[model samples]
Target: MVKIGIADTTFARFDMGKAAIDELKRNCSAQIVRYTVPGIKDLPVACKKLFDEQHCDIVMALGMPGSKPVDKTCAHEASMGIIICQLMTGRHIIEVFVHEDEAPDARELAALMEKRAREHALNVVKLMFKPKILEKEAGTGQRQGYEDVGPARI
Candidate 1:
């Protein structure tokens, strides 16, 4: 399985990211791990933990643009954040920005992120993990496979 790590910087408690990951799980078999950071500045340590400990094959950041529009797009900001992650940890990264209002918008962003990952020569799978409020399945574990990968051997 492709080890994938997803980080969400948005204020929401990874709701959007969870949606996106669910969609990906249906189509692709990737080891998706989701994270939510308090803010943008706290991303480095978070990325370090994801990259170093998780041993993620791909690291993708999720940015959600709410109703009140921001000047810069989430994709743009995520790209910059990916750079910081790359520099800090010497690992290839991919970032996807999901426009939550419309489902099509999220799909469009996912495609773009995938293309960007390809351009960067990284075996990365990037997409928007949108969140949904569906009823949970009975007997299914709530927190499945969200464990840490331990330290990387030098």
Candidate 2:
């Protein structure tokens, strides 16, 4: 079995991070691991473990992109571009949904991400889960979405 590891950081201001994991659990094939570290040293260990212990062929990471939101058109296009760039890595990198209210959940994201992954002949070693905008935060400036690593690594 191809092992995939998911790492996430708790977002104190919103629920999107947790929701992203829930969506990922519902959709993707990779094993999910939550990381609550305050520093980078504690976080990257999972990546090493995925690379060393489980030997996961890929490692996808999920986290909120803490920036003021842009308009819909730019946000959507930019998010898609990021997804495509990640796909070029030949690994899956389900990114946090920039437009949470409008974006699809993990299942849908995985399907889309996988299709893109295959286009570049990259085996999916990891799947990242990004949440749509939290229900309460709808219409706020926050954007949400998912992304995966891509074939550029291959």
Candidate 3:
């Protein structure tokens, strides 16, 4: 059976992870494996464990970077490690980050996180089983946290 690894951060809201898993369960048949860490910098190790130790087919690294340059730097480093892990394992690791500054308020941030995570869950399914869906979406620049700009509006 296919397994998906979810590597989330402890500092961020839990709703994002829950939303991703819920969407995955609603749309895919794969088993969901989750691992949470303290912060973005810690994601790499957790994601590594999921891929190497848990043998997941794909991994989703989810986190909410703080509204500070230092936090961005840490997220960047973690992203690099995730890339390295992907290269070593020969598997896909989807990086989903919702910076704390993305929204104006806590409620808005929560909504955006849910939307982004749910959208990414659909992407995971497409990457694993139905890539055509993503291809179709390309016509509109459809992606998580992105506003669709359909075909250049010609």
Candidate 4:
């Protein structure tokens, strides 16, 4: 059985991890492992632990960055760390970051988080079980939380 890992932050106002897990459960038969930390900066290590200790085949690093410059900086740094962790482990980490500024209100922000997390969860399923589906979606300009921009007209 496939094992999917989820690393999330309490700094987030919403529970994006739950959304991802729900989606995963609806679509696949994978063993889901979750690790929660206090802030976005801690997601990388949490993901690493899930991979190393729990032996997850893939991971989703979910975070919600506040609408501030400092928060943006921290989010970027966390993203880089996640990349490095992926490189070190030779596995895929789907970084799902929803900035608080992306939406005008808390309700919208929460909705966005759920949409993005669920969509990425589907991507995880495709990656693990049906990668050919992803190949078919290449260059389609897919968007998770909002309307897709569609492929560019050259």
Tell me, by lDDT, which candidate is best.
4
The TM-score between candidate 3 and the true structure equals: 0.93
**Each model's TM-score?**
0.50, 0.36, 0.93, 0.98
- Mark the regions of model 1 whose C-alpha exceeds 4 Å error after superposition: 10-14, 65-81, 88-90, 98-154
Global lDDT scores for all candidate models: 0.52, 0.41, 0.89, 0.96
| Per-residue lDDT of 113 in model 2 | 33
lDDT of 2: 0.41
> Model 2 Cα displacement at 144 (Å)?
6.9
For candidate 4, lDDT tens digit of each residue in 1-154? 9999999989899999999999999999999999999999999999999999999999999999889999999999999999999999999999999999999999999999999999999999999999999999999999988898889987
lDDT of 3 by residue, 38-136 (tens): 888888889889988898999999999999999889879988998998898899999999999999999989988988999888899999999987787
Off by over 4 Å in 2: 15-17, 28-30, 39-45, 68-92, 95-154
Clashing pairs in 3: none
In candidate 3, residue 140 scores what lDDT? 75
Candidate 3: stretches off by over 4 Å: none
lDDT of 2 by residue, 1-154 (tens): 5455554445323433345445545555556454443322233554555455655555544433333364345445535654554455454444333323332465554443343323211212222232232343344443122243332432
Clash number by candidate, in order = 6, 33, 0, 0
* Best candidate according to TM-score: 4
lDDT for position 11 in model 3:
92
